[model samples]
Target chain A: MLNAIFSGDTPRSRPLTAILLVILVCLALGPFLFDGTRAFSTLGMICVFIVVVASYDLMLGYTHIVSFAHTMFFGIGAYGMAIATDAMGNNFTAILVGLAGAIALSVVLSLLLGLLSLRVKAIFFALVTLAVAFAFLSLATQLYNITGGEDGLRVRVPRELGPAFRPFDGELRGFSIVTFLSGLFTEPGNLGEVLRESVFKVRFSGRELMYYVAFVVSLLVFLFLLRMVNSPFGRVLQAIRENEFRAQALGYRTVFYRTAAVIVSAVLATLAGVMFALINRYVNPENTLDFQLMVFILLMCVIGGMGTLYGSVVGVALFLLAQNYLQDLLRLFAAQVPEGGVMAELVAPDRWLLWFGVLFVLSVYFFPTGIVGQLRIWSQRRKPAA
Target chain B: MSALEKTLDNKSARRERPWKALGKGPRARFAAFREEKPHLFLLALMMLVPLFMINPTTWAVLTISGLAMGAMVFLMASGMTLTFGLMNVLNLAHGAFISLGAFAGATVLTVWLNGYSGDSSLLVNLVAILPALGFALAVAGLVGLLFERLVIKPVYGDHLKQILVTVGGSIILLELIQVIWGPNEIPVPRPDALRGAFIVSDAIPLIGGIALEKYRLIAVLLGLAVYGLMTWVIDRTRVGVLIRAGVEDREMVEVHGYRIRLLFLGVFVAGSALAGLGGAMWAMYREIITAHMGDELMISVIVVIILGGLGSIKGCFYGAILVGLINLYVGFLEPRLAAVATVGLMVGVLMWRPQGLIPVIKV
Candidate 1:
């Protein structure tokens, strides 16, 4: 059924297919490539965000709905999982139950918001959703008994999923690839052990396990959304987006389609939230249900190119990569500057937000179509010229 | 005659009998009267809550404080409504202007308070307060002009782009403010003369023991004065006519050989100045100014605008008051659910009247 939905997209989506496949392969083997806690964790986060932002694109890009409540749904999923794990043990059943509960809540909430969408105009709809999301954030903070207030809720993973494995050890075992990799950088004898006891002491641990989990979930979500967007249903949504009145006049019940789109998008975002909770082993209002998170997702979609699933993928990947690396790059730059120098402030990690904000504004104005859209345009132009 | 000359002529002519010149005054007043009857009833309903829930004196205090809070919010929200109505720009960065104003006021007060001899005279305090307000308003207005040109001008009609770009602009502005003023909250105290409350019990018999803050009473008066000024300029003047006409049809106004954009820029600057003034007042009200104060309060401002029909100043005032009342009532009733109550009120209001309490019928 999924194949049938996506069959028509094959010819035109060759490049996207290639890009997504490459990402999947990289994510699958990400632990081996980077082989550390930071690498696996960052990769896991990027995977979850890929699903999160792509799901947002379903509403914003394809359906032409600008709902700010997506992050609220995301938070609900994380908090639901966190609460469930707190109530029940960190078993598979609890995770499943939590996910089901979160999806159900999101569906109900999105449907209510959809009804609101039916009542208000586009701008008004955005405000209403923003208001609702803010209320939810406030509730999360205030409901200390359930949500843990500002301190947030932490969960213990199941023993198997927990950080039990050590990738780099002091043992001289030459059989493992981790040992072999560590051998390449360090000296021949006790130097390797010393390095292993010191800098190389960093372990991939359960992060690799979490990475695979996030990877698998992200892959499933991306595939499902891809199929959904290429289906006849997605075409109807696109039609509604392009011209809602005309689509309504042409016998498409726009309200139903729009509501359906929001429902699907909200569910997908909830899934991403659940996966993110697993990776972080925690849930907080700031991390999940923030207006800033919604803006971040919007930035990803726009910077990637809205109306394209692959664009969202590229966007999430690029943005998370920049967010993770840019601070490091700035810190590196900061080290070169003399202490007490005024220029040192220029490269501080805290100043990255200022620069990123400038980049975001400039991108919106200059590259409104985003990276993927721009690439597609260039390609089209080249073909015509040829 | 040139359009400016005609407008001047029209202004002088209307000045002769300002009250009678706008023939719709009485009918508009009647419409407003009919519209506000529900709100008055709502206010009465709120008043009955104090009798049921708490003591009369505490209720009186809460009511006074809430109204004061509403007045400050109205001052902040009015500029937003004007810009949205005239420019078709959803300026998410309006909060930045508010913050800048607060910061400017704080900077002035910090300097003035440091030199003060701790005198309790109202005149001495006013000398310090006037310059602070002027500095804040001027700074905010100038910044608003730059923001319009650099950030807002590029994305005129598109709401999505407008929201994103303005949000980005606001973030940059917020960061810049933090860089300048440091991230810590700057304390902003009220003037010595305006610090305490007046015991209503001594003045009035039935309302005895009801203490209202001297500053709050002043805030209410200030809010009313601003509202009065806005109405006069918007409804009773030739510029008001031109603005209304421009809102109705920008091209038509432009065809009259007038630079509507310049007029709009003036409105934007004025709006920013109002936001700054509100920020300064709010800083005094809160007794501290954070970089995020304006952004934090912006949510309330947006809620007010939406509650009062969008782009309608009168509507925004009513909405602000309603929000302030709901906030106080809920805070007193259930502290945990206080935030939820205002949003709930908004949802309920929107559900009842989708266009808000007073839908401005766009001409």
Candidate 2:
């Protein structure tokens, strides 16, 4: 069942499998297992980013194409939803219209860009996409009347998906089976007391439903990417990446395959954007279209492992964990150091990106293959040769 | 040979005698050039945006400003293109050197030189400006050396890792810059001698005023000097030959007992120095320097380099000027056209020549 769900492309290494399980369980039980709006928001972002980073991996990892316009497609999906919903009221039909329109736009743009530059060198493609993305960003920023400029467009989901609407009249207290099972066997002071204060509360509100929406949609997309990657078409992509000249010699139309990869990746990235706009209820040049986000996505893909669909999952969870918590940890460290000193400045919570930058460089230098790839190597080494 | 064939050849040559005489003049030479170099023909076509439509004064101002902008852009793009040609290292952290140079120049101009920049005496103004430019070059070049060691060296020949590591390096440098310069936009006021414009043609018929800015003229001169120096080095120097040889075949150059590695290092540093020089000029041009200034300029540089043709300096130069002019002309012609002018130019060029305006010729 697990193998089928993972599309027969399991996380081969035992530890990788374990981490994937932990991520899946936590993300699946996010509403019931996490507290505060901050935690839920992080969880929701991780889900959306899983799809986003996976789509990037499809191109960068599978096809070895380094494109920088992934975020532009993301922004398109977001702005599409924002403009349509803003003008036509926040309804389900408007949201669907936005998704369809955004996908259509992404298909055309990505197709044109791919056919034009995919024939060039990788560095050329990367640079051209960067220029295009920068133009798109400025375009989004300049059209303030529609995109709200720097203030961003506020995304309002349909009534059923909105936070104000509840599915039930009353809230349901969350329960953790791990604690209940341990309490039952250990002769706890009160048998049911362990269930009452489970450290997390669950409510049958539209907010929790929104989390589920993001979670379910992301899972479905992730599985689809995995299935696609393991298929014969995906094998051809890998063959081309490994040696494009040889692949061409073997009769594959290399440019056509590359263009198809770009389009599929872009469409998926747009869907991720649709998920983000729905979950966050916001779209802006800063949030949806920043080059910084492009770098971060690349970091996550590399750290987790490129060419592995599950790598994005591991990467998104790991990187976001660092992003969300590393700053607070630094704040505590800054307190330990003297004020106005070099150490304090370096340890400033705002400078967490500096640390991540260091880590990214070190990871590139040391592993180059990423965490999952490294684990697989270790496991293969330990296995006896035939 | 048959007597009829000889007579036919003689008749054909006699028929073209007047046109051959016409071809001996500069106009025919130009026509020959247009036939030989189609990219230049298109470039000329782009530049021939009508002057009769707009006031000649606005046209002059716009053209001069466009040339100045193109020169600064040429400085940055040539460095990038040369480095790529030499070693295949496309350092995304190139903007870091630019930002670092801007900050360094700004520091000298604003903080170190103090009030001397406001002096009317050109020599006194030079005292402040020269040091700023020199210091920017020195600091950014040295930092680029360290960055190459730390970030670029480990990931040679790997474009993917190069992008990631250089970006990481860029992040670290930008943060360090913020740490030193304090995350605020610092103002770099120009020297008093270079503050205003020079009205060169106020009395010309139909053209009321041809006021050219003192600073933009200086920029044009600097760009020309840089281009001349590069052409001299690449054409007339032994090191230039070695660089060209290295680009064609690294192993063969190494086989000749020359340390191609040293050549690579020298080229990277020189490229960084050029970027630093451009950054210093850019700081003064805008009069305000921010940490993200280089990042912002990088987009334009990318567009310039793409249109110029990757790894080709001459192509980059042409691309820069074309983009610069298009920016000004379109902005003045139609505001909406101005919005997509650069992109439109790039797309049009790509459609015509995907390799770029000037495809690299093996020298």
Candidate 3:
């Protein structure tokens, strides 16, 4: 059914096929090829962030409505899951119940916002969403009894998923024998021990498990969104984005479509939020719902290139990577400077925000299309020149 | 002789009449007042209701602060509205100009206090005020001019690009301030003369009590003075007429040989300088200046502009006061709930009146 839906237009099929092949290769090699728990953890983090960026892109890029409250949905999902699994003490029903609650809450909130926001265009919409996000943050903070306020909520991993397994352990040995996966590894060595440790660590830890779950869920969401974007509904949304009045004139209910897009995007964001909760084994109002998070999400979408799923994924990867590395890079630069030098101040990790601000400004000024868009342009230029 | 000149003269005459025609009889005034009475009554109610509900100290402080801030919004937003109405450029860096002005004011104050052992006299402090205001305005004007020429001119009507550039500019300005001033919050002391509260009631009968802060009362008075002056300039003066015409039809004005770009620059500078003045005053009110103050204050100003109806000066004043009251009321009710209340009010107002309370006549 998936193949049938996507099996038209050679131009589109080629890229889609290549992408699928790459994904398959990555999934197949993810466990076997990687060594050290850090490698797997990094990949897991990237995958989860990709989910977040994808949902953000769906609303802002494709729909042309900048919902600044995107992070609030993530917060709701995270808090919902945390409250369910930990406070409610219903592990079996937790994920399901939490997700359902999150979706319902988000849908209702978005509906209210949609009615308020759908009439306005551009900056007004941005401001309204910003206000809504701030409101959510305030509520989350004020309702400290439930949300845990600034401190946040933490959950313990279920014993079944806890990190007790070794490769040679009876339970895993039996599973390996049954699956004929024994040949995948030789006698236990450092590499084997490392792999074993990683697997055990991941299984025992709720966060690691959450990461994997989030990755799978995000993959499914990305696929679902891909389908939506290619569908007639998606086309109508794009039309609404390009020209709302014309779409309305053509008898397409633009508001309804836009609202539906917002709700769908909200659900995707909630999924990411849920996974985020699981990964951290905690949920905090401040971390999840704030101006900083909103700005970062906007920066990700804007810097990545809006209206493109791949752009969002790439954008998040670039942003997180830059963020993670920029501090180290700045420290390295700072170290070379003489002791008590002014340059040292510039290189401090605290000063990273300033640099990020500078980069944001420069990027917006010159590369409004973002890193992915720029790369695409460069590749096109290279092809033509060749 | 020119169409622009003729229009300007007509606008000037109309603006001058509001004050001059104040002597009209109660019956004739009552009839005219009936026409514009609702908005005026709403404004009065907005100002009065908070006083009745909250502690007198809080009410006095909030009212004075709101009016002061409203005046700043009026000044900053008037330019922004005109720029948007005329050129359709959303200058996100407008907040940065406010910050720049604030820093300028702080620098001036710092310089003035350089070698003084004891507290300065009221006369000395009063004398220093002129230079501080001048320094702030000059720096802000220069920054506005440079911003327009360097950054804003290229992306005149392209909103997305404009947004990107201006947002980027704001970030840069924020960082620049951080770099220059360091991360620590700086103290912005009120001049000696402006200190303490004026006892309005030693022991009044009906009303519980009210003792207004001398500084805040002064700030409000200053705000009113500026507001009145701006209204006169915008509505009655020759320059005001050109601005109105320019706002209404920039292309036609340009075609008629008026230097629209120069007019834009003038308005931008004036707007920015006013924002600077507001920032300086805000520093005194908050009693501390930090790197993030501009962004914090900008949020309230943005809410005001959105609520008031963008591109309308009258709307900005009305919107600012409404927002100011909402802010104070919410703060009074629950301090943490202020953010929620402000946003909720804005969202509700936007929903009820999509174009804002007083919709701008789009160019």
Per-residue lDDT for B283-362 in model 1, tens only? 88888999888866887888888888766777888888888877887888788887788788888877767778776635
Where in model 1 is the C-alpha error above 4 Å? Answer: A1-22, A165-207, A335-346, B1-38, B117-119
TM-score of model 1 (CA atoms): 0.88
Considering DockQ, which of the candidate structures 1 and 2 is the better prediction for this target? 1
The DockQ values of the predictions, listed in order, are 0.47, 0.47, 0.42
Q: Which stretches of candidate 3 lie over 4 Å from their true place?
A: A1-44, A155-204, A338-344, A378-386, B1-38, B48-62, B72-79, B110-120, B127-130, B203-209
Per-residue lDDT tens digits of candidate 1, residues A40-103?
Answer: 6678888999999989999888987888899999998899899888899888888989999999
Q: Is candidate 2 or 3 superior in TM-score?
A: 2
Candidate 2 regions exceeding 4 Å error are A175-200, B1-35, B50-53, B334-339, B361-363
lDDT of candidate model 1 versus the reference? 0.81
Model 3 lDDT per residue over B1-363, tens place: 999999999889767445435567885576455434433654676777777778666676677666665665555555666577556777777777778778788877766653221255766776666577778888888888887887888887777667767776777677777766677888877776677767657476533366567776776777777778877998999888888787677798899898988888888878878878877777767778887677666666777777767666777777777666677676777787887777776776676567776666551
Clashing pairs for model 2 are none
**Candidate 1 chain B: 10-residue stretch with minimal lDDT:** B30-39
Q: Native contacts retained by model 3, as a fraction?
A: 0.54
> Which prediction has the highest lDDT against the true structure?
2
lDDT of 3 at B15: 76
TM-score list, all predictions: 0.88, 0.92, 0.82
